[model samples]
Target: MAVVSACIVALSGCALPRSGPKDDEILAGSKAEGGPVNVVLVDNRVAVASYLDDNLSFPSSFTGAGLASTDTINPGDVISVTVWENVDPALLVGPGQKQAFIQEIQVDQAGNIFMPYAGVLKAAGNTPEQLRRLITRKLDPQTPDPQVEVRRVAGDGSSISVIGGVGAQGVYPLVPSTTRLSAMLATAGGVTIDPDVAQVAVRRGGTTGRIFLQDLYDDPRLDVALRANDKIIVEEDRRTFTALGATSTQARVPFPQGRMSVVEAVAEVGGLNGNTSDPTGIFVFRREVQSIANKVTGRNDLGENEPFVYVIDLTRPDGVFLAKEFQVRDKDTIYITEAPFVAWTKILTATSQTLSFTADVVRVGDLLTDN
Candidate 1:
């Protein structure tokens, strides 16, 4: 019995240590020596939901101006020009020619269109109405009181390209003054991934901007007007957070909707291990921007720019509400410290299994000796 007790002590000593600082220890250290990370203790009295409401906001992509209806002609756009002369005898048309003479012309690479009497007229940058007035003026001397009309038959050059994570990638023509971001996406058969978590990127000229698809739907202002030559791309939101320590499972979890709350993140990783996790030591480690960190910690004397550890004590009922309000950002680390008794429990379980196996071996030896 003495030898067995010694063996039990030795085996129990081999158990893993309960690592990480305790809640009270961390708080005590913070009061004594200031650390790099600003540890914010969350409890029932803290207004976490209100803080999130004040700080977190969806980006607005709406420009001040409304959609412009006047679409300028561009190279490769097919246009039709029609001319009606009132005079009985005309140079281009025969005498008593009441029928209008139509000319189908495509804007050349030089941004000019050819007409019978107008010669080479610039059409790429000018609107259809503006081009009509110019052509009518040019034909004034040749044809008496000439009525000229310019219309775009096909707008191939004025099209937006939709690609990446879409059902069908193709070029969609923009209707004059009508096409918006949502319209272009609809033309491409919508995004392949869930729109709530997907990122919609629009590249125009030399600048590019990206916003969550959910933001676009929530705020119509984010669905800005689409322009010709704009490239729209939809992609899955790859934001993720890692669960470690005493959680039911330890793994990296993706935020499919681009946003996740602390409670949801915990649930995603199979929740905290009931037998091993320390309810008072649940923490979310996040490296926030300096401004945000300063606001959250309310401390300017932080030693380093290390990540802040927001501690949540699940032992209290208010902790559930706080966790629900606490939003989890991308690349965050959620750790649940082990309970103090967990190591001893593990040691006892291991010892019991070992002793049971030894008893079975002794019983088999006794049976063999009797035989």
Candidate 2:
């Protein structure tokens, strides 16, 4: 029994159950498969700044200024041309007819429209007024004074496609009033999801860019102008982080906002468990890029795929402030370890339970001997 008790005492550290790894255990397992562990102590301003630098943002490709005019004629637009000649014999209409009304004339793919007597004229890149003047010049030789009026109607080339997470998903035309992205979205009916979590992706030509729908409301500059053939998609934000160990709740929590800090993420999971949480062992695990890993760990030799663990101790005076500034990235694992005393209590409780079971067996043997 003495030998068995001695063995149990020596092996208790390895055999004890735990909610998650301790701080030292996590550090000891940093290196794996020949890659060095990049443990970053996020207790200072520098470390917090390094993590904040990795925030997701709208690139320049998405934020550039867009064209202000939506009235220009493009291919596949429907145009209407009406001609009125005051002379006795009209060049475009019959002798008795006072005016010629041509309607529903669709612009061809080459951006040219044809009139009965005016021939084919370039209509694209010209506003309705400009195109009207062009047509008047074309018929001026035949008639003394030709008055031409050009009207642009809705068609394929002047419209955009709005789909996903909206009240109505379909093709919408870009008129004078609905030329901006927000106006187009409003025409299609507002987003079906929460504006806070909604993401809007704009695909123009060969490039695509995504931004939070709420961003358009926050900064009017981000409300980009809509163009022909542009595809806009609205969807929910998919960024998330995992919470484990001595937290009050353990689960995968989605980002409540576009830019979230470590402290905010902790609060999303109901904060740390009061009974077993170790304030000094709060950690955020991530697969970090080489440049950011170098900045956080002060190591130039780190690889792009290295694993990083950022530690934050709430007991320090600056810890809470650091956590507030340190950004929580997508796919990060936020873990709070159990207190040291909790493990010792577990060991004591297990040993007491074992001793009680052993005494019960011995009493049973004594009863058999008496029988």
Candidate 3:
């Protein structure tokens, strides 16, 4: 009995199976002690405020332009010019005909369009009305009271391309009604993915900007005015976080909505395991941005993408509320450690099973001897 007890004690000293490191072990390995990660205690309002300030939003200059209007002519645009003269024989019209139609007149690269008798005229940067007066003046010397009408036609100069995760993917003309970003998206059949998880990216010239699709709806300023030749892409959010350790489920969970808090993320993974999780040992592992790390750690020695582990103790008075306020970013890892007693429980259960098996063997030997 003494030998068996000694063996059981020796086995208990060995490492037991655990889902992850305990709260104390995580603290010991933090960057304060020259460890791999920086440990942050998110127990006060200041800590929560630091993370809340880091949000995803579009640049202020992105929305500076208001709604777009497709009235002025541009290079590569096609316009039709009609000339009407009351004279029996006009310079622009036929000898017997009173009117003549110059169809499919496209604006050249230099913003100029040529007519038969009016010579080369500037069309780009001028409205249809402005171009009409110019053409009438150019032909007034050759034909008296010559009337000219300039009408813009379908062309590639004033159009945008909408693609990726939309109901329709094509180049849509920017008309008077569908010139804004949201209106153009609607013209392309809106977005096919859920608005909460959709991302909108706009590329114009050499600059580009991105924002959440929901942000475009919640804030009117985010819906900037569209421009000609702008390329818009709508796609699903690819950001994800890994849930491990004693949680009810361990997997890579996709963000269901924008601006997800720590509490919401834990709920997404089925919360912590009631049988084994330590409420005080919930940890979020991530790489903090350099600027944010400097503010959070109160030091400026950190390099870019500093390794960070944010600790949350739900057992504390303000732990749950703090977790509710703290935001979780992309590629973060949430780990919940098992309770300390759970290890002792497993050891005791194993010891008891070993003793029970030994007793059963002794009882069988005694019965065999009696037989």
Per-model clash counts, in order, read 0, 0, 0
TM-score rank, highest first? 3, 2, 1
* Lowest summed lDDT window (length 10), candidate 1: 49-58
In model 1, pairs of residues that clash are none
lDDT of model 2 at residue 221? 72
- State the lDDT of candidate 1 residue by residue for 165-245, as single tens digits: 888998877775347888778778888887767888888777677888878778777778876788998888778899988
Q: Candidate 1: what lDDT? A: 0.75
Q: Which stretches of candidate 1 lie over 4 Å from their true place?
A: 15-38, 44-61, 85-104, 108-110, 303-305, 354-371
Using all chains and alpha carbons, the TM-scores for the candidates as numbered come to 0.80, 0.87, 0.89
Q: List the residue pairs that clash in candidate 2.
A: none
Write model 2 residue lDDT over 1-371, tens digit each, in one string. 79457646864856687888888888776653333666667756555556644433455756676665777889999988889898877777787887999998898999988887779999888999999998888889988888888888898869999999998999988887888888989899889998878899888888887888877888887787777888999988898999999999999998888888889999999998999999998999888888877776666987886788888989999889888988888899999999998887787677777777878999999999999
lDDT score, candidate 2: 0.83
Pairs that collide, model 3: none
lDDT of 2 at 316: 90
At residue 99, give the lDDT of candidate 3: 90
Best by TM-score: 3
